[model samples]
Target chain A: MLSVTPQHFLILSFLLVGIGFLGLLIRRNVLLMLMSLELMLNGINVALLTFSRVGSNLDGGIFVFFIMTVAAAEVAVGLALLVALYKKRNSVLSDDMGLLKN
Target chain B: MNAVDLLFWLFAVLSVGGGLSMVFSRHPVSAAMFMIVSLVGVAALFVLLESFFLAILQVLVYAGAVMVLFLFIIMLLDVGPEAGKGKLSHFKTGIFGLLATVLLVGILLTLGNSYDSLALDQSIWPELSESKDGASHSLPFSTKVSSFGYGLMTKYMLPIQVSGFMLLAAMVGVIILSKKTPDREDLK
Candidate 1:
């Protein structure tokens, strides 16, 4: 039985982050992109918790809580923006959002 | 070989697999489901780290509340499976994939190699007492709910209040933005 080291958690989390990054790149759907953002945040949460455990301190967990709070706020604002975009363009594709480029 | 290790591996696999499927699924609803699974898996990992309070919070906030919000938006939008045909060029995708893979491998190698020396010299606090029996491992610090509550109410009170205010502001903003105003047409 091998011990579950912090290194293992770090690598797994980095893998998750990479997967989320790839999803962000490949997915044109706005909703899926938001989900990818959540994935990336979750990966960062895992890393924070792992470091907290390794250091035997609670600060990391506290930071994770703050991150969750910020993530929630972000989701709220982002969904509102998405709804506005949908109302205006009748589409949720990133390509349809070029109006902001000018 | 041990129960802790076994559970860790299982939850790790579950988390990674769920995340991958969530990203790759074309349907938004199914992708949201996978996201829930991955969130739950991460919560389980939090529990294994002796952060029971955080584990429960993770489940309550992320898996429960946030995901429900996501599902509601997804259902409200009613967008069907995103049509990915002929959107981006294959060369662009290949470039993104290659870049992600290289970044992942580089991070894995660097972190894996340097991890031991990075924090090995520091004295880790709340050091768990080694127990031959797997079930006897106890948290070295008093991480009871009361202590966490005290800390939240005392030392971290300002941030908590700020977060509450932020949440309230977000709620009001969402309501205003999503409201069905008659002038919406004229504004557009």
Candidate 2:
């Protein structure tokens, strides 16, 4: 009989983080990068919930709740920025936006 | 393996596979869809962990609101697949892949031996049988939703209010940034 433990959850979280990180590095599209960022946050949220379960601490859960709020706000702001960038340049590629480049 | 373990494996595979697909997908819309799949799987995992409130919130906020925002932006911009720079230069992609693999291996090695030692601190975690408010309780299990509400109203009140403010600020910021105006100074 196989039993899932906190370690199993931890491993899963780590794998998710790795995938998100790799995607962030390899993807050039700003939208895909934002999605990867969300994936990474979701991974961290899983870890927080696992810890909350193991510790029997509602604090971890509360923390994740706050994280969700922050993540929502982040995505809102990020998408707004992406929209602004697209309007300015008519392209969403990170390479195409060299506005910061001197 | 019992039904729970089987379900765990299923959702775990769904999440990881969806994430991988999101990464490899050529089109932004496909990547957005894959992200939804992954987010739903994470919500399922949250359910299995018995954090029903968090699970519901995960589905509501992430799968519902966030994904909708993502799709909205994707549609609004009409962004296409990343202009073919070979998806990524082979050398850089290989380097990132290698780094991620090394990071995963390091984490596994560290957790392999010490995972057991990472047990919950008994003092901080009250048992289900423990009494609250100097009265004995007969609840067989913790009521997470009530407890969560209590904690938010009491201990975490400040941060909760602050988060609300932050969300409001972001909302205003997004409206200002995205809306077109005749005299929009920031756009110029």
Candidate 3:
């Protein structure tokens, strides 16, 4: 019987973070980019939970709770802004977000 | 070594596969689906961690609530990865993406040793004392929702208040962002 190590969580989380960074780099769409941001947040949640187990306290779990709360609020406000931007400019891509570059 | 470890591995595999697919899948609907799997896997991991409260919250708030908003936005937009295809510079992105992968692999190997050391130093098995072993004794943590309410009102009162404030601020910001301007012709 093998116990899963904290290292497993760490490896997977960093991998997700790397992929999220790449997604943010490669994608031009604001919506996809927001989803990528959520990916990164989930990665952090994994790290926090791993540490919580390792530390013998409920702090990391609480931190993850706070992070989840923030992530929800962010997505709500963020999607609204994305919709507004699209309604104004007819695009979700980042290049079109530079409406103030005049 | 324990039931918790077994559940952890199952959910870990589910999470990684779903997360990777979420990132790479071209279709927005597919990506959203992958995310749902990943979120569920994370919730299971929380259960394995004995944070019954967080587990149910994750499922209810993230999987149930957030995913609904995601689907709504996608449908309202009426444009997914299919509609978004054939427009970006794929070749340039592919090259840069390759470079990033190489860098990421290298960095992970160097930094990952720290994690391995921590795992080696700490005991992996759960420490089940008498309180934990008593099948007849009620578990300290009740159902997810109840324990969460207890936790929030007891040990977590301050943070919960802070989160409420943050939610209020975010709502105001959303209103400001989406509100149509006063001028009738300002939309252009």
DockQ: which is higher, 2 or 3?
2
**lDDT values of the candidates?**
0.82, 0.83, 0.76
For each model, chain A TM-score? 0.95, 0.95, 0.93
Task: Sort every candidate by TM-score, greatest first.
Answer: 2, 1, 3
DockQ of each: 0.56, 0.59, 0.49
lDDT of 2 by residue, B143-175 (tens): 458877777787777898998888889989989
Sort by lDDT, top down from the best: 2, 1, 3
Candidate 1 off by > 4 Å: B118-142
Provide the interface RMSD of candidate 1 in angstroms, 1 decimal place. 3.4
- What are the per-residue Cα lDDT tens digits for candidate 3 across B1-188? 67767777788889878877877788787888898998899888777666777888899988998888888888888766745454567798898799879978986887765754676544663352334344222223333465446556776778899999999999999888778877733646
The 10 consecutive residues of candidate 2 chain B with the worst lDDT sum are: B134-143
- Provide the global lDDT of candidate 3 against the true structure: 0.76
Candidate 1's residue-wise lDDT over B1-188, tens digit each?
A: 66877998999999999999998898999999999999899899888877898889989998898899889988998989976565778898789889888888998888877977534433322475443232222222335676456556766778999999999999899999888889778876
Task: List pairs with backbone clashes in candidate 3.
Answer: none
Q: Mind listing the fnat for each candidate?
A: 0.58, 0.70, 0.43
How does each model score on TM-score?
0.89, 0.90, 0.83
Q: Candidate 3 DockQ category?
A: acceptable
Q: What is the TM-score of chain B in candidate 2?
A: 0.83
Q: Give the residue spans of candidate 3 off by over 4 A.
A: B1-6, B82-87, B120-158, B182-187
